[model samples]
Target chain A: MSQELKQTPLHALHAELGAKFVPFAGYDMPVQYPAGILKEHIQTRAGAGLFDVSHMGQVRLTAPGADAALERLVPGDIAALSPGEMRYTMFTNDRGGVLDDLMVTRRAGDIFMVVNAGCKTEDLVLLRAALGDAHVEYDEDRALLALQGPGAAAALARHAPGIAGLGFMKAATVAIGGTEAWVSRSGYTGEDGFEISLPGDAAEAVARLLLGEPEVAAVGLGARDSLRLEAGLCLYGNDLTPDITPIEAGLTWTISKRRREAGGFRGDAIIKAQIADGPSRRRVGIKPAGRAPARAHTAVVGPDGAVVGEITSGGFGPSVDGPVAMGYVTRGCAKAGTEIELDIRGKRHAAAVVKLPFTPHRYAK
Target chain B: MSDVRFTKDHEWVRLEGDTATIGISEYAQEQLGDVVFIELPTVGADVEAGGDAAVVESVKAASEVYSPVSGRIIEVNDDLEATPGLVNESAEDEGWFWRMELSDPDELEELMTAKDYKAFLEGLD
Candidate 1:
């Protein structure tokens, strides 16, 4: 914690925007701007919200069989990915718990991956040791930006013409103002959006260009967390960790049929076993019947007053206009509509198990 | 007929005779951002100075609204149960958290006046 914090390419812009900074994952990042988290969350759903994702690690795997090597580390069917196709997958430990969840895109001969800011260092170490240091490279010069919302494509289309034609989970290399970027028609906000990885130096200009667009606004980590929470997306350290397996965390869909059947990846046996026989605990969406939000670490009890689990993440869903959360509960209580109680401030409150996401996804598939 | 004072924790107390109305300061509400819910202390509850008397849940975090001085709760703000954003809209007046009878009026002397509170906020940044 004593070490100096890092800054992104858009740090000065965030300061100019009147952002309140906070230290996140070893970086001095903006938590929220003057408009605040609520407005930003709503804006991301209604219009395009730009996020500086440069803190996330942009890694490259340059090898003939990079997909195959990546497949060994993740349970996803990486080798089956067609060129320019992206898949959401997780790096699992030998015990089957997630090391880090990442996005893997199959490039021409090599592969590209984006990892969480906090987990990147360890993820790099793991990848280098497995895929050889010569093949694994994390480019510090690269900066990433996420333009997310229903109007994201419209805003970006003005800058990059072909972006409108991009389908969900598809990737394209497009030029914006002479800067080449690896653009993907995917985002974690459960909305139709794009994740653009471009040169760090050009990042500010591109961000400025997008922000100049009528629909785009600069968002921060605070709204990003709330938006993803309402979207039912998992945050790395909170909802996912080394102690939680892909199956337990409700990410079994990430494991391809081939990998599930062949069982060759790290912790394949355990993961596959859990796949066949359901995990003891399963992550589920929570809806509080009242206004009070049950924040993270609050204990969840079942109908009979038995402790079922604990809330991984919880907060006021600005769009939903109430409290929504996600957590791992006993398999018996994971079903939708199951009654539960959350111990908030020493009092139990009635809540219900609901299907994620709290809102419907509007992907441009 | 009322004296206004501010606490270091950012709560505000408006003392009129023996009864005082309490709420967070504008500076505090802006910091918390978009109040979604608030848990008010019950009427007739006796609370000590600096003790937690209300819970304010913002979109980003949950913070305790402490009593600026020792008092016995006489009334609670029920409006916050439905319109918590009032804290953000009118933090000092309409968004007042509760009303209580001061058990020890001398404690108000330890709080900051309007000028002092403004200076405190200045020193913060």
Candidate 2:
């Protein structure tokens, strides 16, 4: 027997907008709207685009020792985090592999965490085992929404004035449409914007209010992919995974110096060794030579027919107007401008390893 | 009169005289979503029936374009490179992938006719 899937607050609204709904992360999600992926991507880059990310898991960690309890799971220096500041961190398994990546914010002695929907169940179980005395509460009734793009700040400022003052990687509790919400000055898209966490019941009302702004347009997962691709942000399942380390995924910067030396979190020994010795394979950018797009699992080969690596994420980047991809290549060949070959359909297509991301990220600082 | 035939892989070929123009069916395009990139075979290339001849990529997924019949590629629609969405806009007509000079017309017998293809699509659902 199978359980019925969950629905986001915007499921009915997505239907009314004629969005193409698909199953994702145990919930029915909108993949694209009638305006389509290309237009939606370009629109978000130009103006404000709204996303219903309610499928993400929102949780609160409490008790006097909540901060210390979380530090046992993640590699970040959580105890050092200032109030209102949010940090991107990851949970590691005993083998030093990434269990999940998440955002944790210090909120009035307690900690607020938001993690991937797919990893929430396992994350909670792991947290319980590690911090048996701590209070771990999952707010399943809360909904997450992202209002992103260059115009996002202005549009959101109309409803929540203080949100405009929050810098990137910051969080604040604000009032929007007479309802309370936790707004964070952070986004998956490299754009400067806010992610609002509100009551599930009022999420639709908040979404409608944001969309009423002429500059704000509804964006789906389709556009979200392109935007994050252009931003060089990692998609959890594709770019970062339980088997992949943050260092190998070109995310070494996310690991702090204090955590790297102290080494208290799970998998710290193996992860610290990887940091010291460097990963054998490194993620690099691939620009296809021709019109054909290089897709995931396509072999990345050297000149002498030696398989160097395999593509993890590949697509036609609307912003760059060509085919771009990212894959793990041998560390020596991962340098920018190293010409490689992509085995796309049995024939070798010319490709070159370059610095990611394929497109320049424009985040309003 | 032209006979419309389809392959199980979703490619449709319209045969007129000895020339067969091939493209994916409208239903195929709908399933694939908006096409972002189309890899067309170069003219004068030899292609075998049931062989991989091209690649079609949408924002969501990528699919191989299989040849419905064996032939030499005579012409390909260059417009698809600039506007791949044409495959979704008008898959059967303006979005036709290429025209080939048939190496063996007998291969058409293995393909499904319009009535058979309509039934094939129905069984798929």
Candidate 3:
């Protein structure tokens, strides 16, 4: 029954704005608005676009030595993160497979995390088991919203003063609409943006305050998927499944040099070995010839017609005015300009490996 | 006015003389959101009722448009290759998928008229 689907705090607001709802991650989330995915994606690239990401889980850890404890679960140098700094890392299994990808921010004595919605249940369980129930406090009463694009910083600064001072990957608490929110200068769209974590009751008001800006528009999940795909960012479940490791996903750079030698996190042995010897398969950017987009699970083939990998995320990129995709390819065929083919409905279409960020990233450094 | 009919699959056909103009209904376009690319069926090819006649790709996923009646494709819309959003903006008129020579006008009896289609959509919800 549709009643079983959970609604976010901004659900009524989305419906009022003519959003079409779809079942996603146990939530009745907006897939697109009357402006459509293409327009929303373009609006985000040019101006600012608001996205309600409240379905994602926000977890806080501050009992004691939480950052060090989190290092036991991920390979990133968590201990090195200074206050207000953020890092993108993944939870790995003993087999070196990525459990989930998350953003870790060092707050005043606590560690804040944002994880994928679908993995929240398991991620919370894992965190509590490792960090203890007293330390892992799930902020279930909060909402997460992302404001992205070239004009995002200026538009957001209107409500939250001093937001423009925040650099990329920086985090700080700011007040908006008489409510405090954890604002982070980071987003998955490769645009300068902020991910705001605020109380649920104040979500609609804060969202309205931002939307009042002429340059801001309400974007839905459909544009979010296309924007991230064009930005060459990985999506969990589609791109970073439990069977795929960080190394195979070509996220080795996320594992800093200091963390490699310390090596106390889960799958440290396997991940470090891949860093030194290189993984047999590597995630690479794919540009299919023509306009036909290759979706997830599309078989990737080498010039010899041998199956090399499968596309994990793909769709029409409104910014590039074409299709873009990401998938794991054999190390031999992972180089840029390597000829490849995509098997769609028993027919093969021409494609090639290309450098990532199909559209240039507009993040403010 | 030409006789117009709609299929349960959300496609519409209009008969003017021996030629039948085909396109998806507005209801179908709304479900599809923004169409990024459309593969029009080959001109001069024979198609049967309910057969997959064309491909419509939106930003997130793809859907198939079926031929509502048996016919021979006479002309495919070339404009869609450049601007597929016409389907979303005007799926009934300017966004017509193709024109075909009707092979069986009797097949129209199996479809729903404008009044019947409106009631059909109402019953769906």
Candidate 4:
């Protein structure tokens, strides 16, 4: 039986725009508007796209040593995070597998964290159990919106001035339509953008304000997925699972040098070990030689026709105008330009291991 | 006018003597959204009634298009390989997927007629 689906604050607004609804992460989220995914994907690349990310888990951690407390969970250097700075990291299990990847920001007098929607419940439970002394509060009454693209800053600056001045990975409390909103110069699309966290009641008004801009079009989960895939960003459940480690996922950059040596986070021992001697199987980009897209779970075959890996995330990248995929392959076959085959429905199609970000990242540095 | 038949899987068949032209219905294309790629069976292949005949990939997901009747594939739509969006633009007419020589004419009776298919679609909502 299907469970009851939750709706975000912008659900009605999305409906008004004729969005196609699909069940995602327990929420009845808009997968695409009437413009369709292909056009929406292109629009985002050329201009700005507004996304409703309110279903994601937003929480605030308040305590004197909150930064240090968070360091015990993830491998990122949270202690060195200056105020109004954000870092992308993940919570790992003791077995060196990633529990959930999240974005942590050092806010004024507290630390703000946004986790994946599906893992939010367990993540909150885990955080509460581990950090008993710190006051962990889930921000259920807030809505998060991401405006991403090359033109994102220009469109956002119309309503929230000085947002253009905020450097990448920086966050600040700014005024949007006279309401206080926490704006961050960060996004998952590999585009220069801002994620706005504001009161739920003000969500529709803010969304309309952004959409009213000429450059900003309302984007849904479909275009968002393609854009991120083209940018080589990982989706939580698809790419980063509890069975996958940060090192294997090519997320070694998230583990700072100091964190690598003075390891204190969960799964640090195994992570450090993998860092020393490279991981057996590494995540790499796969570019199918044809138009046929090799979707997730498609077997990656070696030259000898033996199954070497499986596609974690694969789809047609509108920007790249071809089929692009990412999957785990044996280290020997993980090198760029290595030839492989994708077993798509019993038929093997020639594929090559290419560098990630099929479309080069256009983030504002 | 050609006698058109429909299957529960959303595939449509237009019968002309012993030959039949097949394609997904307009409703199917609408539900599938923007079709980016289509993989149809090669010509001269044998297909069974209710068997998987082709694969239609939209930006969101991939769906299997089932053969409505048992037949020998005579010709497959090569145009879909170059411009799959045609399936979205003219799913029933210009975007037909394949042509087959009927091996079992009796199987056509088991499918829904155009009128019956219209009612079936209404009941789906």
DockQ of every candidate structure: 0.83, 0.63, 0.81, 0.88
lDDT of 3 by residue, A82-170 (tens): 99999999999998999999999999979999999999999999999998898899998899999999888888888889585899999
The digit string of per-residue lDDT tens for model 2 on B9-115 reads 99999999889999999989988887988889989999999998888999877888999999999999999988998999999999999999999999999999989
lDDT score, candidate 1: 0.92
Off by over 4 Å in 1: none
Across all candidates, the chain A TM-score values are: 0.99, 0.96, 0.98, 0.99
| Model 4: CAPRI class | high
> A304 in model 3: Cα distance from truth in Å?
1.2
- The 10 consecutive residues of candidate 3 chain A with the worst lDDT sum are A156-165
Indicate the DockQ of the complex predicted as candidate 3.
0.81
The numbered model that scores best in DockQ is 4
Name the candidate, 2 or 3, with the larger DockQ value: 3
Q: Write the per-residue lDDT of candidate 1 for residues A1-365, one digit (tens) a residue.
A: 89999999889999999999989999999999999899999999999899988999999999778887788899988988899999999999899988899999998877999999999999999999989999999988899999999999999988898675789999999987677899999998889999999999999999999999999999999999889999999999999998899999999998878889997788999998899999999999999998899999999999989999999999988889899999999999999999999999998899999999998999997
- Taking the candidates one at a time, how many backbone clashes does each contain? 0, 0, 0, 0
Pairwise TM-score winner, candidates 1 and 2:
1
Docking class of 2: medium
State how far residue B21 of model 4 sits from its true place (Å): 0.2
Instruction: For residues B20-62, write the lDDT of model 4, one tens digit per residue.
Output: 9999999999999999999999898999998999999998789
TM-score (second chain) of model 1: 0.98
lDDT of 4 by residue, A31-89 (tens): 99999999999999899999999999999998778788788899999998999999999
Instruction: Spell out the clash pairs found in candidate 4.
Output: none
Which segments of model 3 are wrong by more than 4 Å?
A1-3
